[model samples]
Target: MSFNPFSLAGRRILVTGASSGIGRQIAISCADMGAAVVITGRDPTRLDDTLGQLVGDGHTAVPADLLETGAIDRVVAASGALNGVVLAAGIAKMVPFRMISQAHLDTVLGLNVHVPLLLIKSLLAKRSLQQGASIVFVGAVASEVGPVATAVYSASKAALLGAARTLALEVAKHKMRANVLSPGYVRTPLLDALGNTGAKIDALLDITPLGMGEPVDVAHAAVFLLSDASRWVTRSLFIADGGLTTRMSV
Candidate 1:
C-alpha cells in the first residue's frame, strides 16, 4: 500500500471539551478528515450539537467532567484505543492577586493542568494507543505572554506547555507525538464571555494587531499537528497568535 499520508481514514480520535469552543471545531474537523471521533464534555446538549455536525462515521459523545481524574480510565476505555487525543478541556478565570483563593486556583489548575496529565496517564497504558498516535494540548498564548488579571489562569496553562515539552521527549520512543497549540483570542464562547464589555473588547482588539482569529484557524493548525504531516515533530510549541506575542506594547 502506498502510504496514504494526510488520510486519517482509519484513525480514531478523542477530543475533550467538545461541547463548545475550539474543542467543538477540532472534533468537527477531525471527523471531516475521516477520523472516527469520540467527543467528551460535561454538557450533553452542547455535545450533541457538536456531534450533529461531524462528517464521518463512528462519532460518539461521552459526557464527563474532565476534573474527575478517577473516571479517565473509563472514558478512555469507552473511546476505545485511540489514534489521537486533544486535551482541549480547560478553564480560565480573571482575578487579582489579592483576590485569588486556593479554591479558585485549584479549580483552574485542576482542569487546565492536572486533568490533562491524568488523561495522558490513562491513555499511555500498554497497547492502549496506535503506533503513531498524536496528542495535542490546547494551551493559550498566555502560557508565554502574560496578561493582566490572568495570573492563575496563565500559570496553569504555562504548566501545560512545560509538561507537553517534557512528555514529548519521554513518549518519543513510542512514536507518539505530543505538542501544545497556543492560540490567541479566538471567536469562541469563552472569548465572547470575556469580551462582553465594550471597553474590554476594544482593549483586546487594539493589542491584537490582526484582531481575533476564528476557531477554524486554530482547527486547521491542529489538524496538521495531529496528522502524519507532523510525524517527526515533538516537544515543541506552535503559537497561532496573530502577532500578539511579538508586539512591544507595554
Candidate 2:
C-alpha cells in the first residue's frame, strides 16, 4: 500500500467538546482518517452520539464538565496516551463591554482559556501526550476582527494564539507541535444561537466571500494538521473561514 502522508492510521487522538459542532466533526474526521479517537464533552448523550458516528473502533467517550475539580485528570486518564489533541471545548457569550458581568466573564474565560491550558498541563504532567503530538486549539476570527458584543469571547480566543505559539516553541524539543485553528461564521447550531440577526454576529461588512462554511470544512483543515501532513507546520493560525480573513487582512 502506498504510504499516505495524511493518513492517521494507528494514531490515538483526543478531541474535547465532541458533543457538537466543530469538535464533533473533528472526532468523526479523525476516525475516518483511521485514528482511534477519545471524545469528551459535558453532554453524555451527545458525546455518545458523536462516538457512534465515528468510523472505526477503539474510540472512547467520557463525559465531564471541565470546570469541576479533578475534571482534567479524569479526562486525561480516559484519553490515555495521545498522538494528537484538539482543544475545542469552549463557550461564547456576546455581551457588550459595558454590559459584561463578572459571572459571564469568568464562565467564558474559564471554559475557553482556563480549561484548555489546564488540560494541556495535565496531559504533560501525566505523560499522556506522546512525543511529536499535535495540539490544535479551536480559536475564532473574532479575535482578529473584534466582533461587537464579543468582548469576552474575542479575548478568550485571542489568548490561545499567544499561548499556542509559545507552547509550540516550548514543546519543540520533544518534536511536539501546537497550532490554532480559527474559523469564521460557521453555520452550526451554535452559530445560529449566536446573535441570531446582526452584522455584529458575522463581523463582516460585506458578505463572506464564500458565505458561511460547514463543520466539515474546518474538520478537513484540522485533519491535515493532526496527521503527519502538518509535521513541518507549527505555531501558525489555520483560518478556515472561506476567505473571510484573507479579505479582511488585506
Candidate 3:
C-alpha cells in the first residue's frame, strides 16, 4: 500500500481535443498515472499519434468532430463509464471588438462552450459517468483579462467559468464534481499557430513573471483535479499562468 493521492488507477477517463497540445499532454499524463484513457479529436491520424504516445494500455482513440450532428452521442457511445471528463476541445480566434461578427462569435462559442457542455448533457443522459466523477472545463486567462483582439475568445472562456460553477451545484447531488482550469500563454501548438513571435511573445513574457508555460505544466494541474487528491474540490477556477495575473501597477 502506497500513499499516492494523485494516482488515477482503476479509472476510465475521456479527454477531448486529444490530438495535440494541452489535450494530448493531458491524455498521456493520465495514462502515465495508470488510468485507462479514451481520447477524442477531429483528426483521426493525429488522434492515433497521441494514442501511440500514451504510457499505458487500454487507451483508445475516438476521433470526433463535436460540432457535427449526432457527434456527441457517438463520442459517448464509444467511451465507457468514466471517472473523469476533460473538455479541452476549443478554438481561440483573436478578433477586434469592432470587427466581431455573428459567425465569428458562433464559431468560437460553439466549440468552446456549447460542444463541451452539450457532451456533458449527453453523458448524463446515458449515465456514462461514475460516482464522484470529475468534469474539467479547459478555460483561459482571457476570461479575466482584457487582451487586444480577443473579444470573442474572452467571452467563450468566461462562459466556461460561470458554467462550471453552476454545473458543480447542479451535479453535486450525484456526487460528481465540476471545475474549470484557466491557463495563460501556454506554449502549445495552438499558440504557435497563432504566430508566437516578436512583440507578442515579448509582451506575454513581460507580463508573465515566470515567462510562458508549457503543456506539461497545465497537464499536471489537470491530473490533480482528475485524481482523488482533489475529491473535496469542486466549482473552483484553477489558474496556471506563471504569475501572469500577479503583475503590479506602478
Regions of candidate 2 where Cα sits further than 4 Å from its true position: 197-206
For TM-score, candidate 1 versus 2, the one ahead is 2
Task: State TM-scores per candidate.
Answer: 0.93, 0.96, 0.96
Instruction: Report lDDT per candidate.
Output: 0.86, 0.91, 0.90
Worst 10 residues of 2 by lDDT: 197-206
Candidate 2 per-residue lDDT over residues 1-250, each given as its tens digit? 9889889999999999999999999999999999999999999999999989999789999999999998888999888889999999998767889999999988999999999999999899998889999999999998988877889999999999999999999999999999999998887778877856444555562557988789999999999999899999999999888788778789
Pairs of colliding residues, candidate 3: none
lDDT of 1 by residue, 31-133 (tens): 8888999999989999999999999689999989877655686688788888999999988777878899999988998889888888888788646677778
Question: Cα RMSD to native, each candidate?
Answer: 2.1, 1.5, 1.6
What are the clashing pairs of model 2?
Answer: none
lDDT of 1 at 186: 89
Top lDDT: which candidate number?
A: 2
Candidate 3 global CA lDDT score: 0.90
